[model samples]
Target: MPPRQSPAQKLAAKLLLGGEWAPVTNKIGFVKRPVDQAAVEWRKWVQRSNFQTRDGIGVTEHQGTLTELLSKLLPLGYGTRWLLLETANPEWTAVVENTTGDAHFQYVLRHHLSEVRKIPTIEVQDEPKNMKRLPDEMARGRWGGRNLTVYDEAGFRRSLSLYHSEPWKFHHGGEPYDFEDVEQYSAPRALDCFPHETLVHICRNLGLDPFEEDFYVPNGRAFIVELLHDGKRSGGKKYTLAEARAGHDDISVPAVDDPVIGNALYPSGSGNPNPDAIFPSTGFESYARPTPWDRAVKEFEECLKRYSSYPVRASFSDGLEDLGIIALPSLSSGGTGSTDISVMASATLLESPLAIREYTAAFMILQWRQADDSSAFRSFYPNRKQMAVIRRIYKEQGLYPFDAGSNEVYFNLAVDKMIRSVTELRLTKELVDWEASQPAPSTAEAAARANRSCAWDIRMHIQEREDEIWNPELDDRA
Candidate 1:
C-alpha cells in the first residue's frame, strides 16, 4: 500500500498554484530554497550586516539593541528592501512588504516625521545635555532653506535621533509640534505609505487575511488605496461617505404601489383588467368574421384534386402510344361509311406495331373457337371472306407476307391429325382390356389370348429392365 499523505502535504498539494510561490496571508512572494544561488547571496548579505539566521529565525546579532539590520536598510528605498527581503527567504519575506508594513512605513514618514520637523533647528543639539534634540532630522538642519537629507548611515542615525525625541518638543520654546507642521517641509513621501491597521481592515473586507497577519497588511493597504483612487468619479457632485450611502439606499428601495394588482388610477398591472381573471371586467364583444369567396375556394379545391390524381405506371412504349393518340388528327363527319371504315382501319393499323401482332393472334384463336362451337362455317363465310380480303389487301400493300394458302392447308391437316393421335393413345388400352375378357377355344379367341399373353410378357420384361437400370445401390459412392 502507498503511504498516506500528511495533512500539511495534502494542504500544500491543494494550495499549489501555477506560479512559483505560495500565497501567504500578508502578501504574494516566491519561495527560495536554502541551496539556491540567490538565497546564498542573500544569506551572505544578511550575515555581513547586523542580522543573523539562527534556528530558522532571522535574529539580529545585536539582540535587543535598536540597531536592526532592516531598520538600517529601509532608507535605501523600498525596492532595495524588497529585493533583500525576497532573497533572504522569499517564502516568508512577504511579511515585511505587505499592506501592514506599507502602512507602518507611511505613518513613520508622513505622520511621525511630519510631526518631528516642527521642532526648532537651534534646539536640535547633538549633546542632549546642552539642548533638547529635535523630533526629526529636518529640524536639525540649518534654518530657512530646503535642506537635503541623504539615505546613508549618518543621515539615518540623525533621523533616528529625531524619532527618539519625547512628544517631539523644543526645549527653548517648550512647545510641542504635530505631524502636520513637520510634513510641510519634508521631502516627497514614499509610495509605500500603506498603514498596517488600514491593511488589516481591507484584508478582512476581502476575506483574504483572516489571521490579521502583519506581512499581508502592506499589500492589502496598497490594493485598497488603488481601488479607492481608481473608482468611478461622481460627475459634478462631490459626495461625502454619508451622502453616497444615502443615495445607494434611495436607488435600491422599492416603490409604494403594488405592480401586480390591476388599478387604472395607479397605472399598474399592464394598465388593463387582471390577467389572472378568466374574463375582463368590460365583458365580451362580438365582431363580424369575413367569409371566403366561393368561386375562388372551389377553383383551389379543383386544382388540389387534379394535382392529387392517381399516378399510372406505364412503360416507354405505352407513353409513346399515348403521345401518338394525343398528336393524331381528328376525323371529319362528311365521309361515307366505307370511307370512314377505311380511315379507322388505317388509324388502327398505325397504332403500336408490337400490340398488333398480339391482337391478330387473339383474333385467329377466337375465330377457330367460334367455328368449332357453332358448326356454322357456311353461315360465317361472308365474315371469313371479308377477313381474307382484308388480309389479302394488307399483303398486297406490302404490310405482311401472303401465306393464306399455307394457313388453310395447315388448319385442315391439324384437325385430322389431332383426332387420330387422341384416339390411338387414349382408346387402345380399353380395347385391349375388352379383348382379354373374351372366352377361349376358338381361332379368334386363341388369337386374342396369344396377343394378350404377348403384351403382358412384354410389359413384365420392360418393368424388370427399368428396375435394373434405375437401381440406386448400383451407383458409385466414391
Candidate 2:
C-alpha cells in the first residue's frame, strides 16, 4: 500500500497539477491517489508552457516543495515524478519535448537503481537557457536541446543516452532498408496501421516476446494474416483488404541474416587454398566441391537408391532422416515411423528445382492456415496440373519408372494423405493439451515450454527441413 499523503502535501500536489485533484475513495475510507490522471493533464499543460524559467511548477510557496515532496514519495508511479521534474529542472523540461515524460523518468530511475538508490548530481541553473554555452561534458540528445550527460570518475559517459538524429530504419530481423522502392512502401504502412495494443495481443497469441524488436512484428503479422485470410473479424480497428494484403506481403518474405554474407559465402572456390588453412582434425581434405544445385541433385539420387525399394515413412522424423534429409526434433527415442512412400518420395524430390518451388509455395500457403478453419489448408489442394508437375519431376529424376502409371496414382494418394496429416498435426489441440499438463518452475520455464509446443515452432521445423533439402550447400556432406 502507498503511504497516505498529508493534507499539506496533497494541497501542494493539487497546486502543482494546476487544478483540484479529484481523489477517489472507497467505502473503507481509503483515498486513491489521482497521480495518473493528474500526470496526464499536467503533461499536456507543461507541453504548452515555457518550463525553462523558475516560474514553472514552483509558482506558490507550497508548490515550490512539490519536487521535494515527489522525491520523498513512494508508489507515485514514474509518471507523477516525471510530471514534477519536467518543470522543476530545465534539463528534464527539454527532455519532455523530445520524449514522453514517462520514458525520461525511467532512464533516471534505472540509473538510480543501478547506483544502489544513490542519487546522481542534480543541479539547478539560475542562468538563462543557452544551448551553445552548455558544457561539453553535459549529456544531451540531438532531438531536443537537452543534455543530461553524466560522467564517472574516469571521465567516461555513464548514461545510456540515444543521441543519434538519423532516421531509424524499420527493421524486423535486419537493418532498415530504403523504402524508396514503390513495392516496399506497404510494409511500414502496415506496421504503422496496427495499434500497439493489438500487436501485444498478437505477440501473446503467437508465443512471442511483445518487447523484442525481431519477434513481435513478424509473429504478429503471421497471426494477423490468419485473421485476414480466414475472413474472421479481427479485434480492435478493422483493416481493409489492402492493409491486410500489404501486411501479409511484408510478413511472408523471410528476412535473411546478413545478405552480403548470404550472397557471397558460397562463391566458387577459385582462389588458391591458404597453406595455413587448418585441415580437418579427422585428416580429411576436400574430396569434391559441388554447387548447391549439384549437391542437391546428388542427395536426391542417393535417396532414390536407398529408399525407392522400400515404402517411404509417413512420420516426417523417420522419412526425412532415412532419405538423408535431417530436420529438427531428431527421432527423440521410441517415436513411431509411418511407412508412407509418397510423402518420403516427396521429401526426396526437394532437390528438384520445380519441386523446391512447389514445396516452398505450399509451405507459405500452409503457414496461413487457421487452427479452426479447414479452408485455410487449401495450399496442397490437388489439381491436374500440380499432380502432373509432381509426376514429371519424379519421372525426370528417374525415381518413377517409365510407363508405370500405378506409381503416379500412388504418389497422388500419398501426397494428399500426407498434406491432410500435416494439417491435422498443425491444427490439433494435442500440443496445447500436452503443454498445459506440464508443471513449470517459473514463468520463463513456462514460456519456454509454450514455445517448444507452439504451432509456429512445428511449422518452422518443417520449413527448416525444406530449407536444408533445398539448399544442399548447408548439408554436412556438401
Candidate 3:
C-alpha cells in the first residue's frame, strides 16, 4: 500500500496526470492511496501517446524540390531574376500568398528560366571597357589620342615590325615570310630603288644625322632612304668631297693589298700604302652593308603608315550629325524626338559604344518604371516631349561642356534635360494660353510689359494683370 495521501497531494497528483480522468480499482483487502492511483493513470496516459513528426524544418521533402528549382532557375546566376519575375506577373505576390515556400520558388523558377531562354545568346553584349580595371590611357580618348612619347624606341620598333611584316605571321610565329621576305630580288625594295642623292638631300634637309639619329618618320620611303645614307657613311667615309659636293664614293687615294682594306675600292697605283685607309676599322660591318639599320627604318616606317593615323576630332558636316563624332546620324529638327518610339531608339547613340552601358541602364530603369503599374513614373513619364526638347537643344546649342572625357556626365544631362523639358512644356503651355485670352492693349501696355526688369518681374506683372481682369464666375473659380 502506498502512503496515505492528503487532499492537496491528491489534487497535485491529479494535475500531473496527462490523460482523461479515470476511476482506480482497489486490490482485494489492500486499499490503494490516491497518489498511487494517480501514478498508474499517468503511466497509462504516457503509453497511449505517439511521437510528433519532424516536418517544416531542415532537409524536409519540400526543401529538396525548392533546391532543385533554385538550381534550374539559376544555372548561370546572371541578371535580376526577381525583376524578370515581376515583369511576368505583377500580382505574383498575391498568387503565392497562401502557397508553400516551395510553391513560390517554383513560380519564380519557371519565370526566370523562361525569361533567360527568350534572350538569345547572341543578344548578350560584352561588358564595357570603362566598367573594368582598364589602363588610364585606354579611358582617355580614341585610340589615336594617346601621346606619341608613350612609345619608346623598342616599342616603336616592334610596332613598326607589324607594318613591314605580316602581322599575324609575326605574332603567331610560324607563317611563311611571304611579302616581307626582302631577300628576294623581285620583292619591292623601296629604299634600294630610291635615288642616293635625293635620299641624302632629304635627310640633310630634315636635320637628321642619317648615320646615328633615330626620328619618327611618317613614311616607309623616308625610313629606308635615311638608313641607306647612314650605311654609306658608316666608316670614316665622308658623304661629300672636302669642297662639299654630293658623291657616293671616295676615289682620291691609291690601292693596297692589305687584309684590312679587303676588296674595297682604293685609288690607282697598286702596292702603294692606301691613304684612303686612314680611318680605323669599324669591323666588317659598313653603313653600306644592310643588316639592322635599313631593316629597322623600313619596318618602323611601314608600321607608322599601317598602324597610326593623325588624330582627328569629329566635326559637323552635311548628312552627318555632330553629336560627338561628326560622322554619326543626325538628330536635328526633332528627328529622333518626333515620337516616343524614336526617342527610345535614338537615346542609345548619345554616348560612345564603349560607354553606352550607363545610358542603357538608365533607359532600362525608365522601361521598368513604365512596366510597373504602381510606379508614379508610369503615368507622368517624360519620353516624347523630353526627347523633343533634347533634340532641339542639341540642334541649337550642341553638346555644351560635354566631350569624350565626360560620358557619364553627358548621360546624366540627357536624362536631366528630358525631365526639365517635361516641366518646361507644362509651364510654357500655361503662359501661352494665358497670353492668348488677354485683350489687345495700347502701346503703353506693351512698353510696360517690355520694361519689366527681369523674367520674374514680367511673370509677376502678367499674373497681376490676369487677376485684375478676372471674371470669377465665367472662369470657373470656386
Candidate 4:
C-alpha cells in the first residue's frame, strides 16, 4: 500500500473557476485536522486524487461561470493576481475561495486557436517638414520671415526651378502679370515682355542689386523679384544700395543669349503690339536668388484679411460657464474653464458637450499660460519692490491680504466683493422701508435720521465701486 500521507499533504486542494486554476485566499478560516478513522480515510483518499494541489493548508471550492467569478473578484482588489491550473478544458466552470489570506486570484482556461488572422495594411503619405526638429537658425520667424539659408544646394535648386516655372510677370503699365494664355509661353518668355531697363530702375529704388546676374537672367528674374519683395539683406538687415550692390556681385550667371532681346524680334499683328508674342529661342538659369520679405508680408496681410472675415463673439458671465452649457443652439465650438472647479461647472452647464469644451479650454489655457510665463514682463516685473503697491491697493479697497499660493484667490475675492455689495444694497433698502413706516419725529430726531440715511448711502456706494486697477486699457499699445 502507499505510505500514509502527512497532515500537510492531505489537506492540500486546488481551487478552480471556469475550468481554470484560480488564486485563492484563506483569510476567512483555517483547515481542521482529521481525528476519527473515517475522517482519516477520507483525507487519505483526497490526497490520492489526480488533480493538482498545493501544500494543504486552507482551500475552498467554488462553482460558477467566468463572469460570476470576475464579478466577485473585481470588488475584492484581486483583479491582477495570477492563477495556476492543470490541463486546459472547455465547458467546465468553478470558483475557489482561499481561507488563508484576504487575497484571491482568478484564472480561465480555453483551447488554442490553429490559425491567426492577418492584420490590415495601411499606406502613409510623406510629411513635408518636422517643425519641432528644425534648428533655431533655420526656423521661420514670427512675422513670416523665411530663412532659406538652411536649405542645401539641391534644395535651393529645386526651389529655384519651382520659382521659375511660375514667374510673376509685369505688364507694360507696371501692373503684375496675369497671363491670359499661360500654356503657350514659358515663364521666362512671359517675363521678357516687361521692360528690362524699367525693372533695373525699380530694383535700384528698392535698394537691390540691379546688375546681379540673377536679377537679369530670364529664368531667375522671378527670384530677384521675390527678393525685392522681401526687402532684407543677406545679413537680415533692411536692404540698402550698398548691400544690394554687394549681393549683385555674389550671384553666379550661366552664359546664354538674353531672352528679352530675342523675344523683341517676334512682332505681332500688322505693327500692333501683342504682349503674348514674346518667346526666347534659348532658356537661361540664374542661381542663388533670395526670396523677398515683402512678398511674405503681402501674403500674411491677405491671410489676416480672410481670417478677420470669420465672425467671433465674446460673452461673459458672473461665474465660469462653458459655451456648451448655454441654451444657444447655434454654438459650434464650446468653451470651458481652465481648472478642475471650472471643469465641474462646465459639466453642469454643457451636459453631454462638456468633454469638447473641457478639452478646448485646457488647450487654450495652457497656451495662454505658457505665453504669459515666457513674456518679458515676467522677468522684468519688480517682485519685493511691488509689495508696497499691492498693500496700497488692498488698503484703499478695504480688502484683506490673501495667500499667494491659492490658485483661486482672484476669483474668490471677486465673488466675495459682489456678495458684500448685494448685502449692503439689501440693508439700505430695509433702512428706507423702516423710515417710510415710521411717523414724523422731532427736529433733532429728523436730523439724526437724515445723517443715518446718508451714511448708509455712502457705505453702499463704497461697496459698489468696481476694481479697475488691473484693467486691460492700462496695457501699452507700443
Best by TM-score: 2
- Expressed as tens digits, the lDDT of each residue in 1-478 for candidate 4 is 9888432123222111211211132211101111122122222322332211232211112233332322222111111111111111111111122111122110010000000111111110111111122344333211100010001112211000011112232222112223223333244554333223333333233233212322211211100000011112111112111222121211122212122322232211011121122221121111112333233323332322221222222222211221112211111111111111111122222332323232223322222113223322232222332334434545565543532222233332323233332222222444334434434433332332233212323233333443332223432313
Would you list the C-alpha lDDT of every candidate in the order shown? 0.23, 0.25, 0.21, 0.22
Q: Which ten residues in a row have the lowest lDDT in candidate 3?
A: 22-31
- Which candidate gets the maximum lDDT versus the true structure? 2
Alpha carbon lDDT of residue 247, candidate 1?
14
Report the C-alpha lDDT of model 1 over 157-267, residue by residue, as the tens digit: 111112112122121111222321333223343211222232233333322332222322232211000000011221112221122212121212322122222122222
List the lowest-lDDT window of 10 residues for candidate 4: 221-230
Runs in model 3 deviating more than 4 A are: 1-377, 400-478
User: Please, what are the lDDT tens digits per residue for candidate 2 over residues 248-317?
Assistant: 1122232222233312321321111121111111221122223334444345434433323322221121
Alpha-carbon TM-score of each model against the true structure: 0.13, 0.16, 0.14, 0.15
What pairs collide in candidate 3?
231-287, 231-288, 253-267
Which of the two candidates, 2 or 3, achieves a greater TM-score against the reference? 2
How far off is residue 429 in model 2, in Å? Answer: 24
Worst 10 contiguous positions by lDDT, candidate 2: 22-31
RMSD, one per candidate, in order? 55.5, 28.3, 44.9, 40.2
Decreasing lDDT order of the candidates: 2, 1, 4, 3
What is the lDDT, from 0 to 100, of the residue 119 in candidate 1?
Answer: 12
